[model samples]
Target: MLQYIIKRLLVMVPTLLGVLTITFLVTQFIPGGPVDHMLAQLDGHGARSGADTGESATGGWSYSGRQGIDAAQIEQITALYGFDKPPLTRYWEMLKNYVRFELGDSYYHHQSVASLIQEKLGVTVSLGVWIFFLTYLVSVPLGVAKAVRAGSRFDTVTTLIVLVGYATPGFVLGILLIVLFGGGSFWDIFPLRGLTSDHWHELGWGGKILDYLWHITLPVVASVVSLFAMKTLLTKNMFLEEISRQYVLTARAKGLSERQVLWKHVFRNTLLPLITGFPATFIGAFFTGSLLIETLFSLDGLGLLSYEAINNRDYPVVLGTLYLFTLIGLLIKLLSDIAYLFVDPRIKFTAQES
Candidate 1:
């Protein structure tokens, strides 16, 4: 197991490098980089100032216009943003900085990418935890019940409901939820936006908790409603498959109660596939799946931050977040394999298996 873990960790080095390299290359080739964005802003400002002064305004930095910005000024600005450096040299510098865990500063936020992430991490983590726990807590037992009662009215109704939910997009559900519950031409039960009320700091501890829960409820529901169909159906299908297996029949023939045969024999096997998937789902709780839900609720999370960074051409934040996400994904995959050993001891990890 230790050898397997070490090998996996080593493999992650190249994987991370490859992802980073591709991301860096894309950022380089993309139009409207930091340099061009800054220059465009300068040009707009120059155009306005020149027009006000009754001077002839060339589109970009002018040589002898009322706007003081010139070629030298442009060079200084470019150098300041490190656009003066060759792409390969910048890429090498990025690799070195990343090695020391320095994610660098955001282009516009005036803060380190690490600090920005730290600030936003809590919200995403909170949403993810709520979503992940609620999904399993509700889906697993519901699935088991459905499997046990297959072909019944209850199962048929639930199947239809889940299918409808699965067919609907999460953002669409978020909008519907906002309209119905979030003070939009309806009952107005939940707050329209934000993860907490404005007076959250003034509230008592219990009040604070309740307020937080209240604000999060709509967003969490919107995020997880679509997820339920997949998880619940998967659970139900796995359970149904195991129930039909010969071990379940043999357990029943051996005078075991139906409940005992299902829980003791079938439940363990059903859980293996689910457990195998736990790492991805569990890790995903930290890196949220839906930026739209966050946007709908005005929640400042990693998802929203990444979206904004991408749109604004904030390379540091974009690449920094990508690197961290990839690293976490690699580590979680390793952890998943380790979990399998504990979940089912019959599973073995050998060097030869690689």
Candidate 2:
């Protein structure tokens, strides 16, 4: 196992570089640099922009809108943020930078990426834990019921509901939820934004924690609701596969109770496959919440941070967040493989080596 782990860790290097290479190339190709995003945001004020305000028009100490930033300033800005050089040079720089564990300064937040991640860790981690618990508990029961009922009315109804849940994106669901639950006649009842009530600062830690939970419930629910169908379907498929196996049939032939056969022989194995996907599911949750739910609900997580970074053209934050997320995905995939040991020892890693 130690040797296996070492081999896997070794593979992570090239795997990570490949992931980052694609990310860097794709992100750089995205339209709208800092200047464009800044101007666009200012234009969204629904009033006279800098152009209309006669600043750029009269050459009175203003950028030329999208071209507003003069060359010297642009050069200085680029140098300051390490965007002044060719892409290859900057790429090499970034590789060395992160290898040294320096994530660099966020042009958007004006802080180190690590510092920003630390500050926002609370809200993101809180939301992740909540959704993980909620999704796990929910999907398992629903999956078991669907598997048991197979072709019954309950199964048909649930399958259709899962379709609907999958059809709606998390962000849109978040907006709809807010409209119904967060922003209806009782918007204030749920604390529409932030992780806690304003008075939480004055309360005891436990009180503040309870208040935080109350506030995060809606956002977390919206997130989990969007994911319900997905986890359920994955679990259902796993159970289906396990039930068809010969072992399950043998257990049933022994006159064992259906519940006992399903839970003991079936679930123990089926759930291992499910566990392999759990890490990916959690990573996907971070992305699903990134723009829609976090932005609409105003939670200060990586999602909201990334959104602001995008709108502001903060390349450091954008690229840094991208690296962080991609690394997370890869690490979790590794973790999932390790977890397979606990879930099923009969499963041999060497089997896949060929």
Candidate 3:
């Protein structure tokens, strides 16, 4: 097992390099860049700076004059970031920095990408955890029941509801929730923005906990509802398949109770397929939490930070986030592979076979 883990860890190095290379190439293809973005920001303000150099007050310098200023600024930025060097050299430098966990500063935010991520990580992770727990907890049991009572009224009704929930986009659901329960038109039962109230620090620990949960209710619901449908269906199908197998019948024939057959035999194996999909599930959980729900509810999470960075052309933040996510994805996949051995006795990771 240790040898297998070591092998997988070794493989992740090239996988990460490939991901970084592709990301770099894609960023290069995007029109304009941080330089253009910076110039736009300084359009009206550069005039004041120019006055110190005996330039005009309006700083609406002639095209040639503006070109000269832009040239100088670009040179400074390029030298600072080593952009004038060969692409391969820069890529190598980036790899070195990544190895050292030194994500550079954001061009727009004026802070280290690492610091920005640290600030936002907790909010996104908290939301993801709630959604993930509720999704599996509620879905698995409902799925087992649905399969046990397949074709019954309960199963049929739940299937329909699950389908509806699965089909609805999270953003649409978030809007409906806000409008219905966030004071847009109906009862104002939940807070519409942020993960905490402004006076959160003033409250006692219990009060702070309650306030946090209160603020997260709608966002969590919106996220969980979108996730619940597919997982429930998958679990129900897995259980159904297990229950019908010959082994289940043999267990029953051996005088095992229905409950024992289902719990000890069927359910234990049913989890294998689910366990195999954990890597994708983990990646999905992190990405899905922030994009629509966080933005809609005004939660300051990683998704919002990525969105802002992309719009502002903050390459450092964008690339740093992608790099972190890729590393996590690789690790999750590795963990899932290791889990297979424990989840099923038949699976093996021997040096000879693996």
Candidate 4:
């Protein structure tokens, strides 16, 4: 197992490089740079404020209007941001910095990307923990029961509910929930946006905890509502398939109870296929932070951060988030492979190149 882990870790080098290269190529090919995004934002703000003054909002000297940006202004912006160099050169510099864990400062935030991530990491981690718990806790037993009671009323009802949950969009669900329970004419039970109230700092420990959970309740439900169906159905089908296998029949024929045959013989093997996809669950929890939900809830998580970064062309934040996410995905893949050895001891790993 250790040897397999070591080999997989080594393999991650090239895989990571491939990911980085692709990311760099895509970002480079994008039409506008950070400066362009910044100018557009400023233009929109000026129009909204009805400030016809030739000066920028920041009181910085004016630029040529929507007609065109001047060469000197473009040159200054490029030089400041190191965009004057070739893409390959910029990539090399970024790679060097990333290797040292030195994610550069955000263009607008005036803080290092690492610091921003640190601030937001706890919220995402908490969200992930809840999501992971709910996903497995509810899905596993429900799935097994569905499989065991196949063709029964319970199975039919659950299947219909799962299908409906799967079909509904998460954002749609979130909106409905907010309208119904977040305040609507019904009794309000949760905060509309944010992880805490404005006076959170003044609250006692219990109040803080309660407030935090109250704010997160809707987002957590929204995050996992759509996820439950697929996992439950997958687990159910895997178990159903295993129940039909010869090994399970042999165990049953040997006079073992249905429970033992299912749990000891069938369920264990059923989990192998499910376990193979375990990393996807972790990946979804860790990196894919349900951008729409986060944005709608005004939560400060990686999803919203990435969304804002991309819109503003905050390259440091975007690249930092990308690198971190890709690294996480690779690590989870390695962990998933390691988990296999424990799940199925019969599985062996050889050091052969293949």
TM-score each candidate. 0.90, 0.83, 0.90, 0.87
What clash pairs does model 1 have? none
Query: Candidate 1, which segments miss by more than 4 Å at Cα?
Result: 45-69, 283-288, 351-354
lDDT of 2 by residue, 110-217 (tens): 789889988987778877887887888989889988987788899999999888887887778776777777756545457678888878889998998789878887
Q: 233, model 3: CA deviation in Å?
A: 1.1
In each prediction, how many residue pairs overlap at the backbone (N, C-alpha, C within less than 3 A)? 0, 2, 0, 0
Which one is best on lDDT?
Answer: 1
Clashing pairs for predicted structure model 2, backbone only: 63-68, 64-68
lDDT of each: 0.84, 0.76, 0.83, 0.81
lDDT, candidate 3, 46-150, per-residue tens: 344445545454222212223535677778876765567887887888889999999999887788999999999988898888877888889989999999999
- In model 3, what lDDT does residue 289 have? 49
- What lDDT tens digits, residue by residue, belong to model 4 across residues 263-323? 8888888788777777898878666746887777878888877877776678889889888
Instruction: Write down the lDDT that model 2 would get.
Output: 0.76
Select the stronger candidate by lDDT from 1 and 2. Answer: 1
Backbone clashes counted, model 2 = 2
lDDT score, residue 141, model 1? 92
lDDT of 1 by residue, 1-354 (tens): 788788888999999999999999999887767766666566664346556646444222222332555889788877987889999999999999999999999987889999999999988888888988998999899999999999999999999999999899888998998889888778799996688999999999999999999998998888888878878988999999999999888999999998899888888888888777776687656675668878788888899899878765789999999999999888877887887877688887874554
Q: Which window of ten consecutive residues has the lowest lDDT sum in model 3?
A: 57-66
